[model samples]
Target: MKKKSTHLRALEGKSKSEKKKIRKEFEEVKERLEKAQAKYVQKPKRQKATTSKAENKKWEQKRKDRYNQRVWKGWRDKDMEEYPVKTYNIKDIEKDT
Candidate 1:
């Protein structure tokens, strides 16, 4: 027959109440270890939904329209600059006449 381990021998020497207490404590420690492992385990990444070419083109056009309306107010790039207007002086025109 195989000899019992010192730890097992010690546990065998304990009363029923002591054994029950030890078992309960062991269960609590096991539960804690499982919870810690679950907390540290890496979860799988979620996949993004793929859009069709027509859907992408429609979204792109909508985005462009919104950007043009919000940022440029339907004006083109060339019309957005601040140009200086030529003003005529009345005194200078009379003196010249």
Candidate 2:
């Protein structure tokens, strides 16, 4: 990796080998994301439905949304694994006021 700029977040104070491993894992995730995204070449067009059909579709949509939330959580968990962090103290944060 190139010498990091001051603006970037430093690794979790781990050894260079461990940091490299994390970086490799993240790169793999990025590649997998790119490959998965390639399957969707264009935006999905929504279909218009009648009143009752729309009502039933709404419940099905809620179900799909709940399933997608788990996928979102999986992505978040992978990110935190690579950049495992410690909580900051209030004093450490710069005040905006």
For all predicted structures, in order, the TM-scores are: 0.43, 0.33
Give the C-alpha lDDT of model 1. 0.78
Among these predictions, the greatest lDDT belongs to 1
Candidate 2: Cα lDDT at 21: 82
- The Cα RMSD in angstroms, rounded to one decimal, for candidate 1 relative to the true structure is 13.3
Residues 19-40 of candidate 1 have per-residue lDDT tens digits of: 8887788779989999999998
Q: RMSD in angstroms, candidate 2?
A: 33.9
lDDT of 2 by residue, 8-87 (tens): 34556778897788788778998999999998878788987656977899999999999877766776688864334458
- lDDT: worst 10-residue window of model 1: 76-85
The top-ranked prediction according to TM-score is 1
List lDDT for all candidates, in order: 0.78, 0.75
- lDDT, residue 42, model 2: 85
TM-score of 1: 0.43
Taking all chains together, the TM-score of candidate 2 against the true structure is 0.33
